[model samples]
Target: MLYDIDKERSALVFIEFQNEWLSDEGILQRRVIKDLDAFRDAVRTGARIIESARSNGWTVVHAGLDLRDDPDYLLFNGGRDVLGLRGAIPRAGTWRDKGVERPAPFAPLRGEFVVAGRSGASVLKNSTLDPFLRNRRIDTLFLMGFATHVCVESSLREAHDMGYNAYLVEDACAAFERAQHEHVRKHVVHHFGAETNGAELIARMEG
Candidate 1:
């Protein structure tokens, strides 16, 4: 079913669109991203969604992961290493020693919110995103970005628990493999929120 999205109380949240995930030479890209072409296509779709949101007066939030000062590398600890790669992944510099810059298409525009201090998968855990949305009176979220089964799914579950109306932009997200992406869309997304693509979402925003 299509949702009646309130432009004033809605936000388009982009998660983990940094160089470590989306760029050609991205550290994580080399480690996990299996289909580069498909991943790039999703990134382009996400960019289009952001443009539509901006034109329609919806809030745009960029949730980036910065692990530079994380003493514990929190993501790998506390049973969070679901991937089981643990020490072999994220490397030493990953998002730690390098800059957390996004690719050109995903860069934040003026008036858009860029959430910081997010070292984990879920954007709301250690970031100001929750408070920022609450302060602005926003309750609906359209989430898109890298690794559909990881960060995007994590945020969706948390958003549902927090009572926010969350929608997953299916085509605007990618995982290490196509099957992984399909798994969340088929079995997981509906449990937390509905699944919509960039085109349908843009049409709703424009309408």
Candidate 2:
């Protein structure tokens, strides 16, 4: 289910989809990877949301996560071989290289800020994202990206508190741990009123 908002005042926040997050060598249960597919679907769903919304003159902001860029933005696994953000996220001005290649349903006519990430927890961690979005008067935020329980959840909670109607694209987002995702979504996030999918959201935006 989706919680709709004013498309004119909403911004799609694309979180971490850099090269490092996609693990081609790590060994994990295949069942867990199924949930991780949300990361891919999010790219597809988020792109379409961005396209449709941008067609209606909404805002589109692409933000990524990086650890080596800044030390302060990271926590827990900043310098070690922590599985979270230990890979090459994405280089600035070249994020598209890591993109899934589906065209956005609502492409923006104006330029957007593709803010770089500093670490695993850096998407909304001590970043200029809040002020930047608020300065643009973005009241609702639709987000999809890597680490559903970490960056995605963190940003969702923060954006919600900051007065932005935030939603998590369930099928379009995922986490490093499926158990963690289930735990947070069913309990913690339930207390915060966040949406968890894109099907209905896309329809609402179209309507």
Superposition TM-score, candidate 1 onto the true structure:
0.88
Q: In TM-score terms, which candidate is top?
A: 1
Tens-digit lDDT string for candidate 2 (1-207): 565466657777777544444434222213235555555565577667666666655566766643443443235333345444343322122223333222234222357666543333536656777778778787777777766777788787877676767777665677655677677678766665576666776677678
Local distance difference test, per candidate?
A: 0.83, 0.59
Across residues 1-207, which tens digit of lDDT does each residue of candidate 1 receive? 457878889899998888888766788888789988779889989889888888888789999877666745666773354454345444444665544787776788899999976645788887899999999999999899988998899999999999998999999999999999999999999999998899998898889
Rate residue 68 of model 2 by lDDT: 49
Residue-level error in angstroms, candidate 1, position 157:
0.6
lDDT of 2: 0.59
